[model samples]
Target: MVLYLQYNRGMTPTEAGQIMMLQAVMMTICAPIAGRLSDLWGSRVLATVGCLIIATGLGILVQVNDRMPLVVIAGSMMAIGLGHGLFSTPNNSTAIGTVAAAKLGIATATLNLARQCGQLLGTAVLSLLIAIFFDGRSITPQGYKDFQSVAVWALSISLAFSLMAAWFSSRKG
Candidate 1:
C-alpha cells in the first residue's frame, strides 16, 4: 500500500485508482482457478509452483518504472494473486486438519494471530524502508522503481518460506 503510493507519486489519483482497479480484476479472475487447480493436483505442487511464479512476477514488477505498464503490473499482480489462491485453501486445510474438532477454535485463533503478526511486521518493515530510502517522497517513477525492487526482494523471501511450508505439509500423513 505505501509502496504503491510512493512509487506512483507523480500520477494523478485517477491513474493510481486505475492501477488498483486492475489489480482487483486480475486477482478476481485468477484466484478461483488457482484454488481449484490446487484442490485437484494437491497443495505441494500448486504451492511450490505458485511461489515460484509469484517470485518471478515480483521480479518483473520491480523492473517497471515511470508509467505503470498495465501489462507488467497486471501480470505480476495476477501471479501473486493466483499464488495466494493456490496456497490459502490447502494451507488452511492442513492447519485445520491438525487439530481436533474440539480444539479447532484455538487452532484458528493461533493461525489468525500468526497471520496478523506477519502482516504487521511486513507493513512496518516495508514502510520504514520506503521512508528511509525515498525520503518520504510520493510515488514517482524513480520512487516506484526503488520500492518495487524492495517489494520483489520481500516476495522472493516469502516464496522461499512458502516452499519450506509446502515441504513440511507434504510430510504429514
Candidate 2:
C-alpha cells in the first residue's frame, strides 16, 4: 500500500526503500539484544511481549490511509521488525531446548517446516482476502479503501491470535 501510494504521488522509490532499510536495521539491532534478554528472562515473557508488540504494530497499520504520514508507516514497520526479532530466537530456543537430545534434529526440522507452512498459508489467505475486496475492480481510491478494510479485518484477527498465543505462553507449564 505504501509503495502504491508513493508511486501514485510521483515519489521515487527511495522513500519506500528507506522504510524497508529502517525495518532491517531495527531487526538487526534488536535480534541479538532480544536473544540475550530471552536467555536472562525466559522465552515465555519475551515471546509474549513480542507478540503483543507485533499486534500493536498491526493494529496501527490498520489505520493506514493516503493522508497518513511516512513516519507512522516507518514506525510501524520498525515495531514489527523488533517484535519478530524478539520472538523468533527465543521461541526456537525454547522449542529445541524442551525436547530430548535424541530428537533434536527432528525438532529443529519440524520447527522450520512449521514456520514455512505458516508463512505460505498466511500469504495465501491474505491474498485471497485482497482479491475478495478488489472484486475484480481496478486499483482506484475506492479499491484501496476496500483493500484497507480487508487489511484491517485481517490484522485484527491476527492480533486476536497473537493475544491468544501470549495468553497460552503465560500459562503455568
Candidate 3:
C-alpha cells in the first residue's frame, strides 16, 4: 500500500499513512462488537465470517490499478481491517479456550508466537512480491504498471490464504 501510494499514485508517506488510517479506525471500532458477538455465537462462525470478509477485501484488491481511486482502496482496506478485527479475538479465545486450564499460559504464549510468526511471514511474502516487480532501490515511472501487476498478484495470493483460513475456521475444533 505504501509502495503503491508512493510509486504509483505519487503520494507522500504521510498522505499514504493517513489513507491507511481509515482501516485502523474501522478495525478499532468493530473489534469490540465482534468480541461481543463471538461470545454469543462462538468463534467458529464469527471467525469464518471474518476471514471471508477479508477474502472479499483482497478480492477487490486483486483487481486494483493506477486509475483506481483512493476511496475504493480505502474501502477495501477497511474490509481487510474489519475482517481482522472480527477474526482476532474469537480466534484467539477459541485457540486458548480449547487448552487445559493448567496449560493456559502455554496456550496463550503459543498463540502469540504463531501470530507473530504469521505477521513476519506475511511481511516477507509482500516484500518478496514487491521485490519481484521493483528494482532494489525504487520503482521507476515506467514501472507503475509492473507494480500494479505485482499488487494484483500479491493480493490474489493473500485472497487465497484468506479463503483457506475461512475454510479452516469453518471446521470443528
Candidate 4:
C-alpha cells in the first residue's frame, strides 16, 4: 500500500503515514478487547471469527483499484486489524496453555519461532509471486492487475489455512 501510494498515486510520505496510522489505531483499540473476550469465551470461536473477518477483508482488498477511495482502503485495513487483534492473543494463550509447566519456556520459544518462520515464508512467497508477475515491468494498470491476481491467490490460500485453524481449534482433544 505504501509503494502503491507513493509510486502510483503520488501520495506524500505524510499521507501514507496517516493511512497506516489509521490501521494502527484500529489494531491498538481492538487487541486488548479481543484478548479479554478470548479469555472469557475461549480462543476457538474468537479465532474462527477473526479468521473469517480477515478473509472477508482480504476478499474486499482483492478487488481494489487505483481509483478506490481512501475510505474503502481504510475500512479494509480496519477489518484486517480487527482480525489480527482477535486471532493473536488467544491463539498464543492456547498454544502455551497446552504445554506442561516444565515445557512452558520451550513452548513459548517454539511458538515465536513458528511465527517468525511463517512471516519469512509469507514474504518469500509474495516476493516470488511479484517477481513472476512484474517481470521487470514498471507499475502500470496491467501490473496492478497482475498484483491483484497474485494477492487474490495468496489471500485465498490464507483464508483456507485460517479456516483449517478454526476447525482444528473447534475439535475436541
* TM-scores for all predictions: 0.70, 0.84, 0.92, 0.83
Per-residue CA lDDT of candidate 1, range 1-173, in tens? 23454355455667656655654665567667766775677666665565555556666665555565666676677676666666666666667877999999999999999989989987787777767767867656655667766665665556566556656655644
Residue 68, candidate 4: C-alpha displacement in angstroms: 1.9
Q: How far is candidate 1 from the true structure (C-alpha RMSD, Å)?
A: 3.9
TM-score for model 1?
0.70
Q: Candidate 4's residue-wise lDDT over 1-173, tens digit each? A: 55555555567989977876766777788778888997898888887777777777767766666778878877887887888778778788888989999999999999999999998988797777778878877667657667666666666667667667667766723
Error of model 2, residue 71, in angstroms: 0.4
Residue 49, candidate 4: C-alpha displacement in angstroms: 0.7
User: How well does candidate 1 score on lDDT at residue 102?
Assistant: 100
Decoy 3 TM-score against native: 0.92
Better of 3 and 4 by lDDT: 3
| Candidate maximizing TM-score | 3
Those runs of model 2 whose alpha carbons end farther than 4 Å from true positions after fitting are: 1-14, 140-142
Lowest summed lDDT window (length 10), candidate 4: 1-10
Clashing pairs in 3: none
Residue 71 in candidate 3, Cα distance off native in Å: 0.9
Pairs with steric clashes in candidate 2: none
The candidate, 1 or 3, that scores higher on TM-score is 3
Assess candidate 3 and give its lDDT: 0.87
